[model samples]
Target: MIIGVPKEIKDNEARVGVTPAGVRALTEAGHKVLVETHAGELSGFTDDDYQNAGAEIVGDRGYVWGKSETVVKVKEPIEPEYAYFREGLVLFTYLHLAPIPDLTNKLLEAKVTGIAYETVRDRQGTLPLLTPMSEVAGRMSVQVGAAYLEKEHGGRGILLGGVPGVPPAHVTIIGGGIVGTNAAKIALGFGAKVTLVDLNLNRLRELDDLYQGRLYTLASNSYNLANATREADLVIGAVLIPGATAPKLVTRTMVSQMKKGSVIVDVAIDQGGCVETAKPTSHSNPSYVVDGVVHYCVTNMPGAVPHTSTLALTNSTFPYLMRIANLGAREALKKDPGLAEGLNTYQGKVTYRGVAESQQREWTPAADLIS
Candidate 1:
């Protein structure tokens, strides 16, 4: 099997699909790996590093995409890369197709076998591939929100951890999943008063035990969300519904009622955001004002820390990549039920039920294809 690793071309995206270590692992397993020139440069890995790991360096993006049987990437393929898709090519990446109708259409039209990392599940029904990056994004959400809270950034001039005489800022996280948990951890580390809201009572109780009453955990009803937003100095929208679009927990009206210049870091922006007013921004211009509140909704927050993000992401994805490379997609997916859940689109059909329902498209079970 020939695997390709292309440099991520999304707005301000610096992470690569694989690291030198990953390439070496693939090569040792008798798979040929092709890496785009300088693909890992942003992640602090050089072309020489990939070469030493037994990967051939391709000069252009087209070569890697065209020649490889499976193309692994950090982000979804942008418009320019759409032309490279072929009938049998496998695209393994974070395809948040629920929100991107155009990309979804392209994958179907081109008959590409699309495997989304974000939808891939583990034996315990947890998102293994998405967890590492989500952890990074969740932690960074607080760090970025804190910076944007300064007066110069048009935020409510307040310190996350206040001085001796002042009260700490109120930080509200709208989910208690991996992203929200990491955000709460960082916020509490800063001595900020934190509140985490979620729909699962058992998970909430678990968090209660984990945090030991350091933060408030509330039910995820509309009234609770709105009230929490109003009291929040910084709101972290960390809600997620797997491969589906994130539910709008914080409405525009609720946002308007929040303190002026308050910051919202929507970690769920990749899944179309849980805040009604949230729109994806780039790291270069990460925040915008919406109804007197600041929104920091960068879709690729982990890209801001490419070195850590790339390594962490590859660590989880490499094992699955090797499985597909060694056994082939059909045999590998059929053998592993969890990996089959990752199949969003295969052979011109939507295989993931959540994505099919979200996109309003015809659906087919992955077993239909593999069988």
Candidate 2:
């Protein structure tokens, strides 16, 4: 199989799909890998690195897209790359299609076999591909929130870990999943008072046991969220619903009532955000004031640290890539139920139930479509 790795073109996305080590793996396994020129540069990898790893360096994304049997990417394809889509070619990437109708339609129209990383699930019901980036985003959420809390950044002008004589800041996280858990860990480490909310009592119990009262785990409810928000200096929106849009836990009215100058790090912005007012922002302008609450909604936060992100993401993604390559996507999906869950689209059909249901399209079971 011929695989193409194109330089990510999404706003603030610097992580490339393939690394030199990954290229060597694919090539050693008898697959031909073509990396577009400078694809790895932003991730601190030189073109010579890929060349030494037995990858052919291609100049244009067009050639990579046109010739490769499979095209791998970090982010969703932007508008300019829309026409490069072709039938029979496999597209493996983080296709956040629930929020992007145009991209979904384009993928369907192109008839490419789209396998989305976000939709991929393991037997334990964990997002294997999305976990590493979630860890990165989760940790960064608090870091960014603390920075935004400074007076210079139009925040509450309070330090995350206040001086011994002063009271520490309060952080409220919506959700108790990977992102929220990591955020709470960081906030607690900073000596801030923290609360994480989730509907699952068992999950909350587990968190409580793990943290041992270092932070508070509350049963996620409207009143609890509102109360927490009223006292919070930083609110991190870390909710998720797999391939679907995140539930809007914080409404515009809720934002209006939040403590003045409090900072919000909406890590769920990639899934259209759990905060009602969050519009996708870029690294250049990562935050905006919404009803006195400062919102940090950069969809590509991991991109700001490309070298680390690229390595972290590729490490999680490479094993699956190897599986799909060793046994074609069709067979791999058929044999492994976890990989089968990744089948967002096969050929021209919308196979993922959540995406099809969200968009109100005809849903085809991946089992039926892949064959």
Q: For model 1, how big is the CA root-mean-square deviation?
A: 0.8
TM-score for every candidate vs. truth? 0.99, 0.98
* Tens digits of lDDT, candidate 2, 246-303: 8899888778888899999999999899989898999988889988889999999999
- Off by more than 4 A, model 1: none
Compose the digit string of candidate 1's lDDT tens values, residues 225-308. Answer: 889999999999998899998988899999999999899999999989999999989988988998899999999999999999
Candidate 2 residue runs with Cα over 4 Å from true position: none
Weakest 10 consecutive residues of candidate 1 by summed lDDT? 353-362
- Which residue pairs in candidate 2 collide? none
Ten-residue region with minimum lDDT total, candidate 2 = 339-348
lDDT leader: 1
How does residue 318 of candidate 2 score in lDDT? 93
The C-alpha lDDT values of all candidates are 0.94, 0.91
